[model samples]
Target: MIDTRLSDPKLNDEQGRVLALQRYQILDTPREAPFDRIAGLVKAVMQVPIAIISLIDSERQWFKSCIGMGDTTETTREVSFCTHTIQAREPLYIPDARLDPRFATNPLVTGAPFIRSYVGVPLCTPDGYNVGSLCAIDTIPREYTPSQIEVLKSFAALAAEELELRRVAQIDFVTGAATRRGFTVEVDKAIARYGRYARSSALLVLDLDHFKKVNDTWGHAAGDAVLRAVGAKLNALLRATDVLGRLGGEEFGILLAEATLRDASRSAERFRKAIEAIEIENDPPIKVTASFGISAIGPEHATADQWLAEADLALYAAKRGGRNRSCIAPSSAETQLSRPA
Candidate 1:
């Protein structure tokens, strides 16, 4: 029988856990040496054929590092032992897979890999969310000592620290939003997820209207204050799953996860109004407006650059159609304009 705690929404904070995991922006990214070395160390120290650093995504278990699983980067959550591992505070130890009813029919156990024994420690964030697991696997049934479990826990701590460090490094200083590199990484992951799941998502590229004049008239310090205010306002309006980033200068980007073009249009309109309402405290208060360009992720978008280019085009359209408006790609009929009345 499956553990109700793992499967039931009321018993666990799955949405929060997934959001915490996404905040690290590690999903679908290339393998890093730190995580790879950790997996290698786990394999060597535990004398196991397979060792993995797994991040439990909403629908799948994605491996940041995997040894002994040749070319396999991910698997569905249903067949993943790491899924169960993430649910508990203590290490999950299955000494014999064949004997455990949960594993008797699991594809990983009965088919390839043929895992007979497994031990996994939850990779818990500093705030207490279990995002994934660190595991050591052997082909034959075996019992792991308490000392060994402690070693695994130590490694898991290191992994969690790496994630926290990355999250800190990804933030833009002035705006308190993601930096260009960090935002681009998230766009890449969003593209990969769209390819795999066909889920609808959209990107909005925004540039503040006449931003250079703000710096020219009020000095750079005032400009920075305006940028910070706009960033905070946008952050307050966005959902937990949505990503906001300072792409450079007065330009920003927002990744609206699981939203359609229509949804993005409405959101962009809201953001435009919010930015217009922002007042920066200076010798004289400064109010600003932003022009928005939105592009829904589609099959035509093969890369982040492509997706961004489409939105950028729409942004240009918004600029031409007059500022403080939102435009959607591929058609003028979809453009949403909020001119001064």
Candidate 2:
């Protein structure tokens, strides 16, 4: 968790976090070459038994790739030398973990893995969040020249820049979703081969109701909280296969590939409830809600735009009927209801 008491250094830090992590295409991925090469070189050059390209996430420091290690790819940030390295933004060289005040009792140093000596370089994102670290660890104390430390930090910066550029290229800055350009490029391939590979797909358009009221009554900060809340709900409720993106302010879009209208509605209703349950904790206290419209593509549909429009129309009808409800399309038919009121 981010420390709430201290003034946030980067307000946009969380916005790009998901996107930055995703762009690496590294998490949960099978271990591979590029990162392995870097890790291998760290062990060879630094003469340490362990080297890792570690990415610190919300809960843990996960290794994108590693070498000279087995069955110990990640650990909590509380026990990480990388966490301190990130904050200091300098090489953290602990010559003797048992004697240093900052690390004397640290678990990773005193407990299993018994790190007696450590050196780590912070990996910073472009706008400057310390996203991770490149570290070499030894079981015994060691000394390194200042020049060697500088070189390792330079390499960490290069790796961080590579990861940051990928996020800048593919994600929406505001909502942490794939940019429309990125989504369009990918969605076409999915639709073109529709049933040949997968079944039908569904599109959903969501509009937050009384959003202007939130901004008017509480301020834009409150409005931002509402938007982030909505995004978080959709992100949590949707399946891994579904693609969710914020189309623009107060409006979001989703693509549920291989999902039927019923399946889409089920997922949509879950998100609806999730949003309704959220109570934004901004000063003066704020409560927010949303409405959703859904449309599914059958074999007869010709274009993605058509499906999006259908969802939008249904969303409009949902607004007209009432806020905080869901409307499913084919406007001629009675709208399908989600959560009552």
- Candidate 1 stretches with Cα past 4 Å from truth are 1-11, 104-107, 110-112, 188-198, 297-300, 330-341
Clashes of each: 0, 0
User: Model 1, 1-341: lDDT tens per residue?
Assistant: 45757654532998899989988878888988999999999999999999999999999999999999998999999999999898877889999999999998999999999999999999988877899999999999999989999999999899889888989999998898999889988888889888999887899999999999999999999999999899899999999989999999999999999997779989999999989988887767898999999998877788888888889999999999999999888742333232222
Candidate 1 accuracy as TM-score:
0.83
CA lDDT, every prediction? 0.90, 0.74
Residues 218-314, candidate 2: write the lDDT tens digits. 8887788777777766777776667777677788888887877788888789878888888888666687778999887655445666656778999
Where's the lowest-lDDT run of ten residues in candidate 2? 331-340
Residue 259 lDDT, candidate 1, scale 0-100: 90
> How far does residue 327 in candidate 2 sit from its true spot (Å)?
5.1
**Local lDDT at 127 for model 2:** 56
- Residue pairs clashing in model 1 are none
Q: Who wins the lDDT comparison? A: 1
